[model samples]
Target: MTLTIFSFISFTGQKSKFSDIIKSKMYFKTKLKKIPLSLVKQENTFFYFTDENPYYFNLLKSSIAKLGILNPIMVQPFEKKYYRVISGFRRLQIAKELGFTFIPARILRENLSPSEILTAVLLSHPHPLSLTEKVRIVRIMKDLGISTSQICTRFGSFLEIQSPHLLEKYIRLSNYTPSVLSYISTHGLSLNQALAFENLSSEEQNLLISLGTCLSLKGYDFCNILKVLKEIETKEEKNVAAILKETEILNVSKDVKLTRSQKIDKIKKILKMKRYP
Candidate 1:
């Protein structure tokens, strides 16, 4: 990704707010250069499992195919012959598909620690990131000796996270099963909804995914369904499949005539009308 110039000029021998203090110490002087595409390797360890944003990737690939890459990717030297990509993964991938041998990049100076490289990645991305990406970054920071409090303090506003308390929630989200996580990624599962699913056994989580697909559940509907299911489980102390047999939710979800909202509404009414005794 293009490492755009960020102004840290205020910290140059002038008194600044406490917030700027930590950021001031972490600046890297980057230089723009053209690096061979073959030399840059995609490293998986930098972040947790993140799904490709196909919409963005396609749009980017199409754009680069026409106008060429408007911005450079970020890289740091790995071995004597290869460099590792820190950001702009999609751009690099698309560039390769377009049959280009080299791409523009800003190569960081040598001996930068993993934390520093990660910090630069966090700072250099121009747009808001996906939740998985955020989780990945936090997971890596924790891996590299940065505390959650420090990460929230320094990058919270930039990441658009509500609070430091929520950091743990995202970290927990990172541990979800890949299938469930993929569903979460596709359906845009909210924090509460994801946590709700986390309380389930692995089998139930998979069932939830199946149930969601059958119903074509929206975000609000998904949360509501989970809430009702959770309440029923708590009240009756039964697993999800047993509870599902108690209502027509599965059958109702399969009906093509009803809209998603109508499905959720019907399911809720059914759950509310039934008694577990």
Candidate 2:
């Protein structure tokens, strides 16, 4: 087991959004060691993004098989004689699959707070975060008792959100069901588009999702459909589910003969008539 010590430092004469965290008096050292894979727990607390690209996964697997692990995974001591992963989850997973008994790791010697560990993980993350990842981070930090103002100030650059109000909107996404959140992330829906479902019941939300899947609705079309539904519900004094259950909309949704575009267009025309009449 090779051991090496490294110190954490901030660049001099430079300001950072995480200045509060970087300038803190608390400093900890990390050492590189060969830790047994069994002793390392495969858990992630901060990172939420998953690379679903099969080609990328295959490429990574091939690279690891050929070159072995080029970088050390970061882990912290957990339970007794066990280490919990903080970063390099994918590498660790690939290492396990490749039947490696021991893997290189940078082990944190001192026990740090959750926020500190999260900061370290975020700082070391190499790729741009996805929208879902940003939302998950904001939600996690808020749950850790970090004030909204502090989060906005510290993470605004990292999250690519400069406005506190906008950050709050992202935070509110936590109220959505997991399926709804997944739909929002998969469809690349904007904040306003996702939040349009806020007033909907779970059943109504699910219905809309089913409809969207059946019609292959794009983000803009989905939002427009939601707008039409809300207007119709208001004018007709019925909920979205009730409006959707009407024969015309229901038939159009169930019509296998109609192409996705044709179905969406027919539904839009029917909704417009209901909303206007």
Candidate 3:
């Protein structure tokens, strides 16, 4: 019911610098109101910030179902009659699923720039974000014409990224297949390990994903496997998929008798032998 101009300056400490950047670039008024679900567009405009994990979705749904929406979803006016979601995408989805005709929303004017909308969305979440979320954010910002330097300088501290090179890694990750990205997110794959697959063909990536899943690979083992594969690829001048197929790594991956450790050990041995021999 109350309309107020959001202030970025209110956020202090490390966020104060980030707030200053947003404050200098954009300003928009937001109104707290109950908007009809029909008037709100279901499509996500700032989906980079959204958490796609089913477990988290169910948890959020349960919380909303029990307590109702304690916080208003943020939206921006769209197509004269409808509103696009800037943040709280999960909340909006859950609200619609629960058959709520009207949900509480903080509506921004249609004139807000993409950067402004994105900043508001980013500010909506005060807590730390997941690696996948940070990756997507950098990607989206880059896509919006923000330079990598600006992204690192403005968001690096807030995102807890230490350097521009690390931020660039996140940018590169945006180009990976959804399956690879999802695997990296769920498996806790290091940035280095994930980027190692960047040069691989789609088929090669798929093979590695299958191998990783079969072997239950993570951390150092995964990195070492990639290293060995690259070495073999370089010496033999063969693609990873071809190397894997030739060495029967796929079959080894599927073998029921071999334990995970045994499979990994055998696979590594095969790779080393192929590279050396």
lDDT of each: 0.68, 0.72, 0.74
Ranking by TM-score: 3, 2, 1
Off by over 4 Å in 2: 1-34, 42-72, 97-104, 247-256
Error of 2 at 163 (Å): 2.5
Q: How does model 3 fare in lDDT? A: 0.74
Residue-level lDDT of model 1, residues 1-277, one tens digit each, is 1111212221231222323422343433345678888787654446423466678689889999999988887776767768877667777888889998889887765676666566556555555677766766666667777677766655565555547679889878767777776677778877766777776788777777888877766578788777777778778888777787667678887778998778777878888775433
Kindly report which residue pairs in candidate 3 clash with one another: none
Off by over 4 Å in 1: 1-30, 41-45, 48-51, 245-277
lDDT of 3 by residue, 1-277 (tens): 0111223222222544554433333433444678899887656665455446788789889999999898888777767788877777778889989988988877766776677777666766656787777887877887888777766555655676647778778888888877888778767887777787788899999998898888878857878888888888888898889988999988998999999888888888898889888
lDDT tens string, model 2, 1-277? 0000111222121224433432243423444578899998657545544434456678888999999887777787767789888778878889999999999877754567777666656655656777666777777787778777766555665567658789888888866777787787767787778888787999999998888777766689999998888887888799999989883676798798988778888888888778776
RMSD per candidate (Å) reads: 5.6, 5.9, 4.7
* Model with the higher lDDT, candidate 2 or 3: 3
Report how far off residue 168 is in candidate 3 (Å): 2.9
Per-residue error at 84 for model 1, in Å?
2.4
Best by TM-score: 3
TM-score for each predicted model, relative to the true structure:
0.75, 0.76, 0.81
